[model samples]
Target: MTIQIRQFPCRRDNFGVIVHDDAGGPCVSIDAPEEGPIVAVLQREGWHLTHILTTHHHNDHTQANAALKARFGLEIIGPVRERERIPGLDRAVSGGDRIDLSGLEVEVIDTPGHTAGGISYYMPDEKLLFANDALFSLGCGRLFEGDAATMWASLQRLRSLPDDTMLYCGHEYTATNARFAIDVDPGNLLLQERVKEVEALRIEGKATVPVSLGREKRTNPFLRADDPGLAEAIGMAGADPVAVFAALRERRNGY
Candidate 1:
């Protein structure tokens, strides 16, 4: 039951992840942003790559899938609807489909706001979520295909996960996200504290992600879209959850 995570740098400050079951032998690469870092980490850790899990069709997330597959012969798992978008599709899965990796069960969630066929991986046993491009620490993904309502529903699905779930989003955008969170919720003491803490981490050249769901609920403006205070901060009426979420996301897009 040993679960490990390795982070790699990718396109224009994005991130790629490696999730491994120490006893399962091969690991799952969350998104193939680049090949060099993935190769280096796999060689260093001696972890076999069993699968490549894609969240969407964005090139930043799927560009290296073919190369990785050619090199390792690993399975590529992506949204069933995105068969044409993603390269080397060994398995096409949809929402609620469960895949077994050795002994661990991974649940696929169809979160389609970021992309038409975006999907997220949730490992309840490890309390880990590979929430690529959809939800960040304090921000949500831009509306590329889906509308605000769809994004809201997608985020609400993520909010229903256990509070302790560790969220691993697809980019190193937490510092900027925290700043935006503060702007949207200046009255949130938790966000205030987190801004300072995250700033310090950035000063030290560290990552501020793998942020807990509990913390996101308490401090993240995107996740707190149901709060009245946040709605007002964005010049909206009380507790319009969808409105608040949409406003926050739009602001972050501009931020």
Candidate 2:
């Protein structure tokens, strides 16, 4: 059976997600951004909470891990590399490991750059990616602990996913990301169209997440960093893809 998903705003820009097969089946939260909203969604949906799939040790992503575990006694699973930092983490996983949620396996992929221990969960059966801070709609996380080459490799792995895959991220930064993307790839017609849509959505106070991987591949400057045209747009033509990616990430840092 396909998993059902519920996404709602947590503290500030953070978004909390819960997935399950049915109301009676075991439910899993992607990250515990906050305890109150996570509990609110579970209670409102009448879904039985059983586990939490933590993406990283970042406070915005794992701040409620301990509190949620105490409230629900749910299993806390996180990146093995950050075991010492994730509060209440019961299981540590790494790239290539598969975790079970409602009888379906969630493939864990190591995605560093935002943080050295960052990981992303991919539900191949559902074609859903909980990208965390590693990759966003049109932007990505800042280079806090990892270098450009490392983050670029992680991003390439994500880009290799099926074009139809739907992406879900932790924050609501798409509106701003779209703006930066247009500045860097102004000639991209698709980006132009998507930016209009993003602006309208933000004006109405809507979430611009859960975008298609195909859309991101074509329009997101970060994902397109390896494209010669994208590199040329930023005056980095013929530059190594890693160098192009580094320039884009650096520019976004100040955007």
Candidate 3:
């Protein structure tokens, strides 16, 4: 089954993703930051809203959840740990819990770092990962609730996905993240080149999202925190994965 993904930018840099099945049986909205865009996309495609999958309980991610659920009678699914925080959570899930949407089976992946109960939706058949604040293209999310160790481990889970997996993160922070990446890895030719590409995309008012896992592996410092070069840049002597990850995240938070 073919999967269709539509990313809508909302409130500052937040991204709301809309995912649909091939035959259009069930469409799931990921992180409803606003009602208008999500509704417009559903209406435009004539897709039935079956589920609202929330990665975290942040207002920018779940503010429109209640409105959308009421308007479309959509079932809300979120991490069980944050059920009280996210509105309309009909189904509370943790890592490894599977939910079927039409013929698509979405596997839950607990990624608690940006928030206490953040989780990503992985569609193995479509090789799509809705990795909200847990993972971004050029950087990882800030440690709002969980610590660096948790965020580092959370990112490791995303890094373990297939190289060609399509990563649908929860924000449009690629360009700014790329800038920070360049700072972290100045000698990284791939990141230097990507910074230019990202700048061009931003200049043209285009979104730099849904970046491939392979692409991110090659340029994103957060994903390459285990690389020897990356470890050295952070003043560490060896390929100490956690140190690299911590340094990159700390630098990004200040960036």
Candidate 4:
């Protein structure tokens, strides 16, 4: 059975997502950016809220947790490290844990760069990843709580997933990310093409998410730290991959 995913914008730049299993067993909300939009989507799709899988303790992601829980009596799952922080957290999970959402098996991955206790969920059967703020299209989350090395390690873990994995992130920051990517990797023809595509999409007010892991490997600066060309472009030739990644991240901060 195929998993059905519904992604919609909510709360300025954040995205609200709903994932439903084909067997009609469980319909899960990836995050609750806001109460009204999420509730509206559930009503429109005729999907009953069964679970709320939170990636971190950030307010924008968990702001609607309490309201949704009261409205639908849904199970709230979040990182074990952030159990005390995330609102409405019913089940605390960590890396290597497997959550069974009815018939679906969701693998928990530790991704703690964006936050001290960030987590990502991956469904192997569907090749889908709910990365939250850990990874983004042609970009990555800011190193808010973790250091560059720590974030690099987290990103490497996500990069190890199959190239075909469909990554659904938490925001609509692709246009800005693409701009920074092009500035740093101007010689990359693939990046050039991707920037144009991103520009066109944003012009149409369309979402540029659920990007393929393969495309990110080729075009995302954070994921391309090991590439010799990227290292040279950033004047960090022969530097360690992590160091190159750190340099790019620092540059992006000011970009």
List residue ranges in candidate 1 displaced over 4 A.
none
Writing each residue's lDDT as its tens digit, candidate 1 over 127-243 gives: 998897888887789899998889888888898999999999998888888887887788888889889989998899888888898888888777778877778877896757887
- Give per-model TM-scores: 0.96, 0.97, 0.96, 0.98
Q: Mind giving the per-residue lDDT tens digits that candidate 4 earns over 59-145?
A: 999999999999999999999999999998999999999999888899999999889989999999999999989999999999999
Native-referenced Cα lDDT, model 3:
0.86
Model 2, runs deviating above 4 Å: none
lDDT of 4 at 121: 98
Alpha carbon lDDT of each predicted model: 0.86, 0.90, 0.86, 0.93
- Which residues of candidate 4, in runs, are more than 4 Å off? none
The true-versus-predicted C-alpha distance at residue 42 of model 2, in Å, is 1.0
Better of 3 and 4 by lDDT: 4
lDDT of 3 by residue, 1-255 (tens): 777888878878888788887675678898889988888888988887888999999898998998988888989999999999988889999998999876779999999988988999999988899998889889888888988788888888888999999998888989889888887789988788889999999999998988789889889988887888778877785856876787778878788
Q: In model 3, where do residues sit more than 4 Å from their true spots?
A: none
lDDT of 2 by residue, 52-74 (tens): 99998989888888888888788
Give the TM-score comparing model 4 with the true structure, all chains together.
0.98
Sorting all predicted structures by TM-score, with the top scorer first, yields 4, 2, 1, 3
